[model samples]
Target: MLNGPLLVTERLILRPPAAEDFDAFAAMCTEEETMRFIGGACSRSAAWRQWCTLAGAWHIRGFSMFSVIERSTGEWVGRLGPWEPDGWPAPEVGYGVRASFAGKGYAFEGAVAACDFAIEFLKWPQLMHCIDPANTRSQALAKRLGAANAGATRLPPPFETAPVDAWTQSADQWRQKRKEF
Candidate 1:
């Protein structure tokens, strides 16, 4: 039930999650490959709780990952945006696009908008992308977004054992890189 500003890109719309976005969100959660680096696949009930967590974050923290939507077809593409739950290493602009929408650049497009929202609106001084060691695709994307590998770091509990590499860039760096796009 969170209604926040919609971040419109050329081919996608990033907005707060709604009740209608759940089924697709849950389906994405069940996709093993898609959820591999993102805490693994889960049951529909677990997805519900996870979805609620993201939705509730906006009300409590004033920001959360956005439910990505395709502009032309209005399909739920995936969820991607700012996320920094308790004990997180840093403010992050993370992303996950549905398997069907893979390679379409929706993640990159949405991430750019999300970074802008985070650095400009949310006023975060820096941004990080906590990518898993084996997630090469995300590493490439983070590189393409002008973030550099800042070395390894363990996440907080539940994910404390997860091997993660921190990719980061400063707000000034983001603004300069954004202008080049």
Candidate 2:
């Protein structure tokens, strides 16, 4: 089993999701805008299942999204980290911040932490962001991270039909590009 580690960034703590984070997770997952890029807003029960799945991914694959906690307020602001499950096109350092947490650079900072963890701990050779084509914010973020749209790939159904872009960067590219961050 993989023990979650605390990843300290300048303004956030990237740690594994815990039982107590369910409420925050629920709030985020239930918001239409917050989930617009991923799946649409879902029921509370559905959110719980998603939360549990993220937590379970750590044990299953030795890596999963870290619950991004604001170090100052100690609130669970988002989820960001390494993610790769069966059927995924590639290993990814993904990030999703709550609606209120958006525009504060939490996603960027947390993703940087997660990327560091993915490279150092998970030892992935490359990383990808399975992004929706219409999500301009995510597109900008991916570009900022030096990830370019490498190709097209389908997500698992019912999202299979959604326009998914494969944004990617090699380990060496990250090492070179990360210097700017």
Candidate 3:
């Protein structure tokens, strides 16, 4: 029901969530390492609800995390894109890739595209990535994306107890940084 823009990179395709993406989405949500900083592994039913929440954002908010697909194999790699649910600290370009695809730069590629979409199309003035303190990999990714640690912030309920650092850069800063890519 959601028809949004399709972003294609050299190795991946980023698009709105589709029904066929559920199995992979659920699998990613259930992986302990994958979900460790993302509120821990969840049951398939919980994953379904989360997937629905992501999908529903497209309809309700006109934007959400995009389902990432491997271009060559057409496999679901993960989800990455603009996300800002109610009570969010700021507009964010978040990312998560399947464990099997870790360290492959797919997350970076997809995130770059997502940042462009968020800043250019969504017209957000700033972008932020809320990362747990222990998530060094993500912190490094944020640095690679030209975002700087702006300090800490508590998330909305359910995750309010979790500690996270905010990494941010304004649209103008992103535009300047993007030219280096």
For candidate 3, list the clashing residue pairs, or say none.
Answer: none
- Tally clashing residue pairs in candidate 3: 0
Across residues 1-181, which tens digit of lDDT does each residue of candidate 3 receive?
Answer: 5478899999999999999999999999989998898778999999999999999999899999999999999999999899998998998899999999999999999999999999999999999999999999999999999999999988899899999999999999999999999
Clashes of each: 0, 0, 0
Per residue, candidate 2 scores C-alpha lDDT tens digits across 15-84 of 8889988999999998899899878899999999899999999888777999989999999898888888
Poorly placed runs, candidate 1 (over 4 Å): none
TM for candidate 2 is: 0.96
Top-down lDDT ranking: 1, 3, 2
Q: Give RMSD to native, each candidate.
A: 0.8, 1.5, 0.8
**In model 1, what is the error at residue 150, expressed in angstroms?**
0.4
Overall lDDT per candidate, in order of appearance: 0.95, 0.87, 0.94
Q: Which run of 10 residues does model 2 get worst, by summed lDDT? A: 1-10
For candidate 3, the TM-score is 0.98
